[model samples]
Target: MAEVEIVVAHRERATLRVGEVFLKVDADRARADAEVEAMALAPVPTPRVLWRAPPVLALAALPGTALDSTASPAAWAAAGAAARALHDAPPPPWPGPSPEEIAARLDRECAWFAADDVLPADLLTRNRRLADTALRPWTPVFTHGDLQASHVFADGDAITGVLDWSEAAPGDALSDLATLTLGREERLADVLAGYDADVDTGLIHAWWSLRCLLVVRWLVEHGFDPRPEIAVLEARR
Candidate 1:
């Protein structure tokens, strides 16, 4: 058989054109893709899952660039609206990992830190405190666990599609907003305004700070230099 032609290569996955089929593959990508396809709802154009083989899933090729590279404010608004629409979609009866399971995973990651690093400790504590206070009263909404621009695609002022549903879960919507914002505060403001979101900006900022700290600590533990960008973001706090 002739080898498939590679179209795009992303971090741990690749998009390939295999004869008449477009294949998107990475371990565990199928589960999320399957879930998204099975859930009946609005007109969101999630990739059509053709086949599943554990870590490898094949999806129809979506045509567009990742929203991260798109500069149009209208495109950003469309992305925000798409996220809101996905959140409003009724979820399937799939059993997601529980809070205890997530905490255990975090605990495993936290174990990588040594006494010299205080950021992880502070992050864990802050997450707990926020869970009790701010997040407690908020209604849980379906969240794109890793709602970053890299996972979205846009065409001019319209969102062409969204990708990477692996981290899809039920959580506070503001967390997703914070993740999307990351280092783009102005864009974040624009997105919030465009979406007419009622989330507390202060809390989102707090979470953004904590999330950055978590990244810094992870880099430190992995023997990477936590300099420059991390230092700058930390200085802003």
Candidate 2:
């Protein structure tokens, strides 16, 4: 029998690994379509599409370990290089959520947190101070909308491949930088050096706070603890 592993399983989607092939079952077909298209457009290496059907995408796995906060600075630099390549590539046909939309969502989420007493009002208010920095306008590039550390794959100092492109679209490049470097400030310099662009540290920090704040409620609802992200936000103050 082939080795089968459940990579992820949740209400929105599930990914199963059978031997070297990965089967991603998504609740939304549009997301699946975006993944397929993004993979084709990405300048960096990505999982090969074995096939695709509505709600499921089959891909050949690439060899590497998942990128994480604990990885060495060299690895983070490599990830940055890969990201630079992705951003340098032409934008996808579809655009990501606009700043206005994201800001509105943030407003709603903050309200929800306050209304539900999810956290001390002061903490939320403190983080919201830098929130506007993140919502500022920026040039849109090809971005991996959900560029989590876990989504990047690396071998030693080289980036082997990136996974999970369902949210890939034309969006802010700093958002990706902020996502990868979240809670790992030590790697920020190396990553920025490899990115080969002028990046605003303040905005990156702002995005970091904004990203964590926006996801906390969703993470809680998904049965995942938001403590780690919360800690990062708290540390910013």
Candidate 3:
């Protein structure tokens, strides 16, 4: 079997090469495509959508690399600037699940865990606790929900494009900030310092903790072990 050359593999979506075009598919690719189209009107580097379906999108390919731990400070700065640009863009018509709605969804997922009796009891309780406490306050902005190093692409110091729009939504920018802040604290600090206004580190930390719990639940639901790093992060809360 010939495997598709995957440019990026996300939990919910994958970017695969089909000849010269790239296909993005998952449960939310259509919405993602629309969002990206809307974002393109602003001054940001998003992949150009060529076609769309509810859970699939076709985009033009761009050259770059994922901003992993080995990425340069310039890459982080580019990502930060891109994020700020997206946040500043006019709100799109595509509606995102509200925090309260997301909380409800989490509760439903927790129920699945309870019914299956697969997840530890403490895990469920902690997930709810963090969702309630940390994610409750904050204004929502257009956020790339999974803005980690892996979703960013760089050609030298410049960010060529941002990838994985599956989780793109109107949410607390802190959520995006937290994901970007992972691993490289000093670089994260520098990125924030370069932002237009002061960012609340406490809020970013809180969102990070909450997002960690959510990631754990997602892993458990999908039958993968939550790595020690994720486990430790969730426990620290």
Candidate 4:
């Protein structure tokens, strides 16, 4: 019998790994459906969809280890390359969250952080100033929306797969790039090299701060550590 390992679990969703298969159970069927659809439409390599029935979606595990902070520059560049392909493809069908919606979220979270003393109001304030740069309008592209390093897999210089398409949507291309090189801003050059595009480094920095600020609260609420995000914010200082 394949031992079931809980990859991640929370109130909204849970992922379980049983040997070679990953079972994602999402409370929101629409997100799961969107994930399936996004994977199908993506030009780059995504996990093989074994089966899908409502909340339960089974996927075949990709080869190689998940990309991490310690991954080499070449691996990071490969991730950037994969992201470039995805971003260059036709945008997904969903409208996703509006810019106004994201801005509201950031404002609401900042207010909460100030009143509640969640992480550090001062840190949040400084980062918020920088974060504003990313809130501007940009040409929409096929964005992964949550291209965390952990969601990408690579074997040496080649990326074997990219995972978690639940947040796939039509959005800013730099947002994906920013998420890819989150805390490791030093690797932005390597990623841009593989991306083979001229990206504004300052704007990417803004997205980094913004993304960290927005997610820190959610991560704490979801029983996950926000230190990595906080560290990114701290790096800015």
**What is the alpha-carbon lDDT for the whole of candidate 3?**
0.69
RMSD of each: 4.9, 1.3, 3.9, 1.3
Model with the higher TM-score, candidate 2 or 3: 2
TM-score order, best first, reads 4, 2, 3, 1
Off by over 4 Å in 2: none
The residue-by-residue lDDT of candidate 1 on 1-237, one tens digit each, is 757898656555566777656666665555646445443333466666777665666666566777663468877777778777766766534544454554465454445433455444655455434433323344455666677787677767777666666666666667777777777777886678656767788777765654554465656655557674354344442
For model 4, how does the per-residue alpha-carbon lDDT over 99-149 read when each residue is reduced to its tens digit?
788899999888877888765667778889998888897888999989988
lDDT of 4 at 134: 89
Native-to-model Cα distance after best TM-score fit, residue 8 in candidate 1, in Å: 10
Model 2, residue 91: C-alpha shift (Å): 1.0
* Per-residue lDDT of candidate 2, residues 1-237 (tens digit): 898899988799999999999999998988888889899889999999998887888999988888876677888888899999999989999878999999999999899888998768888888887877889888899999888888898888889899999889999999999998887788889889889788889999999889988999999888888998888888876
Off by over 4 Å in 4: 119-121
Native-vs-model 1 lDDT?
A: 0.61
Task: Give the candidate order by descending lDDT.
Answer: 4, 2, 3, 1
The local distance difference test score of each candidate is 0.61, 0.88, 0.69, 0.89
User: After superposition on all CA atoms, how large is the RMSD of candidate 1?
Assistant: 4.9
Clashes of 4: 0
- Model 4 TM-score on a 0 to 1 scale: 0.96
Q: What C-alpha root-mean-square deviation, in Å, does candidate 3 show against the real structure?
A: 3.9
Clashes of each: 1, 0, 0, 0
- Candidate 3 per-residue C-alpha lDDT over 10-63 given as tens digits, one digit per residue, 9 for 90 to 100: 576667887657887776646566656554654677777788765777887667
